[model samples]
Target: MERCNHGTIMRVYRTRQLWGSGDDTFGRLFWSFGPSIHAFSRTVRPLILIDGTHLRGKYKGILLAATTLDGDGGLFPLAFAVVENENFDSWLWFILLLRQRVMPVDKNNNEFTISSDRMKGLLRAVAEALPGSYHSYYIRHLNANLLKTFKSQKLCKLFSRAAYALRESDHKEAMELIKAKNEKAEKWISEIPKENWANVHFKGARWNVLTTNAAECFNNVLKGARELPTAALVDHTRWKVQDFFHFRRKAEATWKTHLTHRAEKWLDRSCSFGSKFLPRTCSWNEYEVLSSTHTDSADLEKKTCTCGLFQTMGLPCGHAIAAMGLNKLDRYKYCQDWFLASTYRSTYEEVIHPTLDRTQWPEPSYDLLVLLPP
Candidate 1:
C-alpha cells in the first residue's frame, strides 16, 4: 500500500504468546493515506478530533480515529488505527504514531488542538505523547455526565451556556447562574480546568468546534463497515475517503463565492450586524465602533477588535466590519485563507488512488510473514 501511495504510512505490530511458541499475532495496525496527510498539512485547520469506537468483527477490537474539519466545515478523517482495546497503551501508541507520522510540529513551532470525549486514558495519553498540543474536552460528553450525575435539565442547559460562551464575562455570568441554582453542580464543573471545556479560556484556535462530533459523525458513516474483518474494514475506509475527496473536488468548482458557503454566511451576518454600528476614525487603521449599548476599538492593520471574535475566529467581527466599511476596505481580504475556495480546492487537489483487484496484485519483493490474529 505504501509503495503505491507515495507518502502513505502503514505499520503492523506483532506479538507472541506467553510461551513464545507460535506464529506472531497481530497486536495493532495503523495506517494514514498520502493524500489525506498532504491535504491536512496544507489546508485543513490544525484542530483534530480523536475518538474510539468498538468494532464488532469476529475478533473484537477498537477503531481509533483522528478527524478534522474542512474549509466548508465538513468532517475530514485524517488517520486511524485498530487496537486490541481502548486503554492507555493503545491510546498512547496510536497518538505517538499520529504525532510522529501524521502531524509533527514543524520548524515554525506551530501548535494544534485535539478534542475528545473523556475517554479512558486518552487525556493522559495526549499529555504524554503530545505534551505541547492543547487538549479540549467535548462539551456534549461533559454535559451528558452532568445530566447523569445530577439529573437536572436546567443545570445541563446552564453548563452548555458556560461552555459555549465567547467572552470571559459571559462565561463567569453563566457559571454564577449555575452556582446560584446548584452549588454542587458548580463544584463538579470547577473540578475540570476551564481551558479544556470553556471556549473563552482555550489557549488554541478550536475554530468554534467544542465537541468530538466530527469524529463521531465519521464513525456513524462507517457503522456498517465496523462489522467487517480487519483488512476489509481498512479497505472500506479507503474507498469512503476516496469518495469524499472526489465528491468535494468536483463540488468546489460549482461554488460561486470566494470563501466557502459557511464562511460567507458568517461574514454576511457580521456585515448585517456591523451596519448598525457607526465607526469613528482614530487613525489610519484604527477606529472606534459605537453602537447603542457600547463601543469597541477595531485595529484594521492588526486584524483585531476589542470584541475578541475577530482574532479568535479568523473572521472579522461586527466592529471590525464596521471599521472596514468606514475605510472602504475589502472585507474578504481580512478572512483567513483556510476558509477560501482556493484553499478548499487545494485540499482535494490530489486523488486517492484505488487499490487493484486481488487477482492482479503484484508479488512481494521481500519475504512475507504469515501472521495470525490475536
Candidate 2:
C-alpha cells in the first residue's frame, strides 16, 4: 500500500495495534477509495449498504464494505476495508472514517440511511457513530434468524408480510396473523424496532430493497482479489471499480427516457396494472381506486397512495397510476429526480485515473512498516 500511495493522491488510511514485549501487531485495518468513487458518492442515492465478508487468502480477515445505490437500482461502490475482524470497534472505525472522509455530514443530522443484515456489533456502532442516520435491517436476514428457532414456513411467510407490508394497517394485519399462529414469533420480532425492518415505518426511500444484497454483490466482485497480497489487492479492486464506472457510464449514454431503465420499467408496469382499475374522482387530486378486494386512496397532489408503494418507491403505484389516468395527468411528472438517467450518468462521469508506474513514484515522507498477519 505504501508503494502504491507514493505515486497517487488517492488516500489509503490504516490503523494497527502494537503488541507488548515484541516487534509485533495484533490487528490492522486498511481502507481506501479512488477519485471516481469520491465523485460517484456525490451523485448516488443517500442510502448506504454495509457488510463484511471473510477473506480466503493465506492471511484470513474480514473485508468490510460500504456501498451506495445507483439511480438504476444498481450497486455503486463507495469504499472498502480489509479489517482484522467485524468487531464493534472495527465497524466504528470504518463508519467514522466513512463519515469523515467520504460523507462529511453532521453526526446528529439525518441525511443518510444505512441498510445492513444486522450484524452483532454493527447496530451499536451505527448508533454511536451515526446517531442521526436511519439504520434498517434486511428483512430476509431477520426471517432467517427466526427460522433457526421456529421452522414453520407459515410463520416465516407471515413475518415476511409484516416486513414487506407498505400500509400500517396491512402490516398490523400480518403481525396479528403471526401472533395467532405462534406468539413466540410475534414476541421475537417485537424485540426489533419496527423502523429497522418493517417497511411501514421506514423513514426514507428503500427503493424496494429488502436486503443488504448490494454489499454482497460487491463482495462477489472482489472474490478473487480477497486472496491477493495487501498492495496487489488494493490495486486489483481499484482497476475493477474503474472498469465498472467506465462501462456503466458509456452504456447508459444511449438511454432515451428521462428516468432510468428500471424506473421506466416500473412505471410502465404500474401503468399496465392501472388499466385494470377505473378510478372514481372525489376531487381534483383525490380519487378512490377500487379493486376486487380492497380500495386505496390516491392523492395526486400529495404524490402519495394509501397502498404506500408510491411514497415508498418514489414511483407511481397502480392506484396512483389509475387515479392519474382518470384525471388525465401525465404519469412521467410523478417520477422522482432520484431515478433519472441524468442522475445515473452523473454518478459515473468522473474517471479513476490509473496509478503511475513504481519507478515514477515519489519518496514517502515517513517510513511505514509492512504489516504481517498476526
Candidate 3:
C-alpha cells in the first residue's frame, strides 16, 4: 500500500488517496489519553479542572476531563471518560476517576482543586462523594448568559455592577436599580435557574457561589470537534491538546515559580484567617449574578471589577477581590503545586501504590507463564 501524508496525520489505509479512497469508513477506537493519570500527576498536582464536552460517537454524550490548572500555560488533558451529557451520574463518574487517580498518593484533599462549569447535579454529587476543594465556575460562561439576558449596553452595565459588587447592601441596590430601569429584568430573581444561581450572592444574601468558565472552555474545545466522527474527533483533539501541553510542560520552572510566589503571597494574607471566612465544607448560598453598573475603577484589588477573570480561575483568583475581603484572601485561590507550577508538582508520598479495587484479585506465583522448547 502506497500513501502520502494526510497533512499532519498519516494515513492508516489507502487505495486511491492517502486520507481516504473517497471513503468515510474508519477504524473503531476507544479514546485513550497520553500518560496515565499517575504518570501525568508527576507533571502537576492538587487542583484539577473538569468539564464534559459533547460526543459524536454511537454513544452520544460528553467527554469529561480532569486537567492541571493552566496558570503556567500547562493545560494537559489528564484523565477523561465518556459521559452521558452533563448530569449527576456523569459528574459522579468523573469525580470517582479523579479520586482514584489522586487519593492513594495525596492523602489530604489539598491535592485536588476542581474548576468546572456550573452544573448543579454534578456539584451536588461532588459534594456528597468527594467533598473536597472544587472551584467556582468561571465567569466567561456567565458572560455569555448575561449578554443574552441583558441585551442593551445600559442593562449589561447593571450585570457588571452586580457581578463585582461585594457589599451585601450594594448587591441589593444594584438589583433594585435594574428592577427600576427595566421592570421586566426583575424576572432575573425568579427566572435565573437556582442551580445556575449557586454561589452568586445578591445583596443581603449568603451562600457558596461561583461561575463555571472552565467547563465552558472544555465545551468550546469540543465544539470544534463535535461534528467530527469518532476516530478523527479523538485523534485531531489529542494532537492539539498534547501539543499545547508538551510546550507548556517543558517550561516547568517558569510556571512553578510564578504560581508559588503568588500562592505564598496570598497564603500570607490568609493567616489569622478565621474559619468563618474559610469554611472547611461548602454551605450553599444565594447571590444574584452581577447585573450591575459598569465602572472604570474595577481593579483586582477591589475584586468588584467588571471582569470576572480572577473569580473564574479561582486561584487566589483576582488580586482585587483578595483585597476587598481582607480575611478571605487565602480562601479564594486554588492551592496546588501545579497551579503554582512549582518545582515540586505534587506531594504524593512515594510508597507502594495500593489497588483498593476488589477487581485486583491475588494471583498465585506458580501461575506465572513459562516457556518450553518444543
lDDT per residue as tens, model 1, 206-267: 77788767999999999999999988998999999999999998898899999998899999
Positional deviation of residue 173's Cα in model 3 after best superposition, in angstroms: 4.9
User: Candidate 3 local accuracy as lDDT?
Assistant: 0.46
- How well does model 2 score by local distance difference test? 0.78
Alpha-carbon runs more than 4 Å astray in model 3: 1-47, 57-59, 102-113, 118-123, 132-135, 138-153, 165-173, 183-241, 249-374
Best by lDDT: 1
**Model 3 C-alpha lDDT per residue in residues 105-177, reported as the tens digit of each score:** 5455533455555665776867766765544444445556666877766666675566555545566677788
The segments of candidate 2 whose C-alpha lies over 4 angstroms from its true place after superposition are 1-27, 30-41, 104-108, 280-288, 365-374
lDDT of 1 at 56: 92
**In terms of TM-score, which candidate is strongest?**
1
lDDT by residue for model 2 over 249-324, one digit each (tens)? Answer: 8889889998999899999999888889869989988999998767989888888888888988888999999988
RMSD score of candidate 1 (Å):
2.0
Displacement of the residue 209 alpha carbon in candidate 3, Å: 12
TM-score of each: 0.95, 0.87, 0.49
